[model samples]
Target: LLVALGSGGPGAPSPSGGAGAGGKLRGSRTEQSDDQRRKVNSRERRRMHHLNQALDGLREVMPYSQGPAVRKLSKIATLLLARNYILTLSSSLQEMRRLLSDVRERHKKRGSYSLVFFGSELHGEM
Candidate 1:
């Protein structure tokens, strides 16, 4: 026989048909459920904490101002700014490499190495 103790919610089955044992079983299940919920909540909190820490680290390495008067960047802004900064640096490196290659080619053509002025060349003067 099965008997519910309080609100007829998940009562245990017993061969001798007793409400006391069924109530204890239900209570145990409820406690286990609560404990599981607490564990999940704790894990979620830790995950968020770690994520925020990583974002803060990214902010530190970025080129944005970190003055006291300056407001902190939002998560989205920080990510976008970092991405753009990387792109700019990449472009500058590529330009430098191209300039070096041109200088090398010019050196090969002249046979005699001469002092090459890159100041005007960088500004569109050949």
Candidate 2:
């Protein structure tokens, strides 16, 4: 989305040099330009609203404090935290897969395995 910022209001000069045209044509073009400017501004405002909403949704799912006393995360902070979280999860998942592979290899060699959990033992054989 390319948006042209800065002032281009009624007092601004028309693109064509002012010498040739009559008053009616100038007035019409000015009205058209103003209308176009308004439409562009409206679209820009809507785009920003949607962007902020998406950022808010991201903040909601983040593992940060959500209490009223805590200030909402700034846009940069929200994005950085999300990136860090994804990297952490990716690393943890890789570690878990490696551990599981080791356990499976041990079970294959023994032809049976016992998995203990919370003071309980689960014994199984292939």
Candidate 3:
């Protein structure tokens, strides 16, 4: 996990080297390429750091916490599930509202009704 976070690990190159073409002078032409590569890496790392911070914030607000009680969800998985849940909830609310409106219209037209279960097979006659 530490290695994945770019914190520290045996495979990671030491950061003690100075940021200059001197570091890659073995191949003069490759020196500029190395600098460009480092710039791209640094930009990518910063972007990922910001994204991870946002994910951490999301985890905090979500109902579950990391423990034996509940396993921690990955950032991507949490976001996907959150989107699905919100969409489902919004759809359900809209359906309920529509049903209520339909029932009100029915009551106004026919005067009364008993047990009207919307969206299901359940229906009755007063």
Best by TM-score: 2
Candidate achieving higher TM-score, 1 or 3: 1
lDDT of each: 0.72, 0.77, 0.69
Badly placed stretches (over 4 Å) of model 1 are 1-26, 112-126
Please give the RMSD to the true structure for each candidate, in Å. 8.2, 7.5, 11.7
Off by more than 4 A, model 3 = 1-28, 64-68, 106-126
What overall lDDT, based on C-alpha atoms, would model 2 receive against the true structure? 0.77
Worst 10 residues of 1 by lDDT: 1-10
34-114: candidate 2 lDDT, tens digit per residue: 899999999999999999999999988888636778799988998999999999999999997898678878997889988
Return the lDDT, model 3, position 60.
70
Sorting all predicted structures by lDDT, with the top scorer first, yields: 2, 1, 3
Residue 13 lDDT in model 1?
A: 49
Q: Can you write out model 1's per-residue Cα lDDT over 1-126, one digit (the tens) per residue?
A: 123433334453454333434455556666778899999999999999998999899988887647777788998998899899999999999998898778767876766444435544332223
Ranking by TM-score: 2, 1, 3
Candidate 3 residue lDDT tens string, 13-120: 334433333333345455777899999999999999999998877777665445578877888787986677679889999998998778767866776655546546
